[model samples]
Target: MNASVDTAGAMAPQDVVNLARYPIGDPDSPERAALVKSLRDYLDEHQYVALPDFILPNARSRAVTEIDAVSHEANHNSSFRNCYLSRVKNPSLPEDHPINIFEDTSNWILAYDQLPDSSPLKTLYHWDAVREFVAEIVGEDRLYDNEDPYQPVNVLIYNDGDRSSWHFDSVNAFTVTLMLQAPEAGGDFELVPNLREGELDNPDGIRAVLEGKGETPVPVAREPGALCIFRGCTALHRVAPVKGATQRLMAVMVYEDQPGVVGRPDVNETIFGPRVAANG
Candidate 1:
C-alpha cells in the first residue's frame, strides 16, 4: 500500500515531518520508499535508527513550549536497580551480579496523560500519516495507539542528580522517542547495540555492562527535535544524568501491534502514579 497523507487532511505528513530531508508521506514516492528502506536496513544492522531533525523547527518549538508549561503536573519517582527498571532481587544470582547491582540515580518522568487535550505531542502521536510511516518502517502490518492512557506516551525528565539506570525494555519490541530539550551537560543516550538477541539471555554481556567492563556503549548525540527509533527489547540503553540548570526532556510515543493491550496496573502505578478508569 502506498503511504499517503492522513485522510482527515488536517496536517499533511510533509508539513509535520521534514519531507525535504526524509520523505515519508507518500509511499508511492521514490524518496519515501528509499527512506523507509534505509531506515529498515539501519535498524536491521544496529537494532535502532536515529533521525536527526525529523520534526520541523516551528512545530518542535511549539511542542517544547507546550510541554514545558505543564511539566509541573508530571509524576516523579526514584529507584536503584538493574536495566529492566525493576528493583526486585533474584535470590539465585550472586550479590555482586549485574541483576543485583544498582547504579545511577533515579530519573524523573512526566506521564503523557497529564498533557492537555490540545497538546501538540498528543496530536502528533495520533497523526495517521505518522503512524503509517512508522508501521511501514518497522515492518508491522499496522499499529494502534496504546490503549493504556498512562502508558501510551510520556516524557522522561532528567534534572540535576537524575540519571536512568541501565535497563532493557523487554516489554516492547520497538520504541519511538523524541528529544524536546537537552541539558547543558550530560544526559547522553547510551546504548549497547544488540546486547541480547531473541529470547536468549546474555547474562555475561549484561554483567559486563553492569560491571563497567564491557565494550564501550555507543553514545547517541542528538539535538532537540531529533527522533530515535529503538529496538529496546534487545538493545540495553539508558540516559545519563543531567547537569547544570537545564533539564533534559524527551517524549516517548508508544504503539502496539494489537488492540486492547493495556499496561499492568502495578507497573502503571509505578511509572505514571495513580491510574484512572480505563477508557471505554
Candidate 2:
C-alpha cells in the first residue's frame, strides 16, 4: 500500500479500497479470478487470509478519524470468559480442561447505530461488489448483509492493557475484518488453527493450547488498510494486551449465509451494553 500515493481527484467509496491491486469490481476480469483463486488457496490451507493494501491511505486515515470521534460513546467492556466464550465454567469437566480455563478480556465496542449512513464503514459494508467477492472467496453460493440494528458492523478499540481472550467464533460463520490503525507495541493477533478436527473432541489438544504447552500459535501480520477473512470456528485466537498510549482500531463487518439474521438478545446486551439492547 503506497501511503504516499495521492489520488489527484475525488474517489468513490469503493475506490477507498485499492481496486487497482484487487480489481474486484470487475468480476469477469482475469486479474479478479486470479486474486480469488490465490486467496482461496491460502484460506483453505491456513483457514485465514490477510490482504494488505486492501484500502487506500486516505480511507484508512479517515476511518480512524471517524471511529475515534465516536469511540467515547462505545461500550467499555471488561470481563473474563473461557475459550468457549462462556461466562460460566463447566463443573463436570476436570479443572485442567479448556472449559475451565478463563482469561481476562477488555475492549471498547462501537456499535453500528453509532455510525451515520455516510460512514465510510457503511459504504464498504454495503458495497455489492465487496460482498460478492467475500462470498466467492469463502465458497458461499451467496451471502447477505446481517440485518441487525447494531450487529451488522462494529469498530473494536483496544487501548493500553486491553486484550481479547482466546475464543472460537460461531462454527457456521466466516469473519471479515478491516484494519484501520495499529498501536505502537503489542496488540498482536495470534491464533492456533485447526486445533480441533472433524466432530471428535480434541480435549487434550485444546487443553495443551490453553495451557500454552504444545502447538505453537500463529501470529497474524496485518497493517492498516489490510482486509482479513478468517474461519475461526475451530481456532483458538486472542489479541495480546496492547501497550503504549496509542489505541488500536479495527472494524469488523458481519455477513450471513441467509438473509434476515439478527444477533441473540443476550448476546447483543453483552456486546453493545443494555441501553440499545432492546429488540427493535
Candidate 3:
C-alpha cells in the first residue's frame, strides 16, 4: 500500500503494503466513513470542519469536566497568562520577530508533558482513544511522540476579555480545537480557509480581514463540545477576545509532520512554542 491518503482519506494501493502494521481509523464503520468524507470535503474547499459533540457521547461529560479541571489548575499554578511546553529561547530570530514574541501572561496552557504524573491533565498522556482519532485524520501510522508528539494537547481558558491574536500554524498540518465551554459572549473562532497552500507562507490576507482592510473572514462559533479541525498551517485563524463573565475554555489538539520538527530551549517561552516546524 502507498503511504499517501487522498482527500477522501482512502489509502492508496501502495500504502496498503504496510497497512497491516499501521492501523488507520478506529471502529471502521459506515458512519466513520461518512464522517471522514465530510471532514475531507469541508477542509478541501473551506479549510475547516466542525464535528459537534465529536467525542463519543458517553465520553463527552468526562472530557468536559476533565478539561475544565485542568483549566482551573493551570490558571492557579502557572503564569497568569499563557503556559506552553518548556523550550529554549531562539537567538536566531530577531528579538522583535513574531517567533520571539512572548506574552508576560497568557490564557493558554499545555496539557501534555506536565510534571507530577497525577496532575489533572495527565489523563491525556494515555488518551489512546483521542490519539487514534487524530492519527486517522492525519493519516499517520502513529501519533507524534517527540518531546510531546507531533500531536499534542493544550487547554485554553479565556476568562473575560482574553483573546488570541490572528496567526498561522508554523507547520504543514492541521490543529484541532475542541470547545469545552464558551463564554456568554465573544470568543468566536474565525478563519480564512485554505489561505496557506503549504510552507511557511504568512497569512497576511486573513490578517487584513481582522484589521478591517479586507473581506470578512469565515467564523465558526464553537459551542460546548464542538470539535473543530483546522489547517492552521495554511488557514489564518484567531479567537476573538472573550466577553461576558464566564470563561471560554477550549482544548487544542495540535498535529504536524515529522519534517516540521523544531527543538527549543523551553516550551513555555513561546506563545506557540509547541508548534513543530515543517519537515525539511
Best by lDDT: 2
Per-prediction count of colliding residue pairs?
3, 0, 28
The lDDT per prediction is 0.78, 0.84, 0.54
**Minimal lDDT window, size 10, model 1:** 1-10
Top candidate when judged by TM-score against the true structure:
2
Clash count, candidate 1: 3
Model 3 misses residue 7 by how many Å?
35
Which residue runs does candidate 1 get wrong by more than 4 Å?
1-14, 275-280
Ranking by lDDT: 2, 1, 3
Q: lDDT by residue for model 3 over 1-280, one digit each (tens)? A: 1123122432222232112222223557666666566666766678787766544332445555555555545532223221112234568856543344443323755445332233222233234545555566655666652344322556677877677666666544767777777789988888777654645444344444545675577888666756787777676676777888887877776544453444453533343343323321
Residues 79-121 of candidate 1 have per-residue lDDT tens digits of 7777767678888989876678777556666776666544556
lDDT of model 3, residue 247: 78
Superposing all C-alpha atoms, what RMSD in Å does each candidate have to the true structure? 3.9, 5.1, 10.5
Better of 1 and 3 by lDDT: 1
Error of 3 at 200 (Å): 7.7
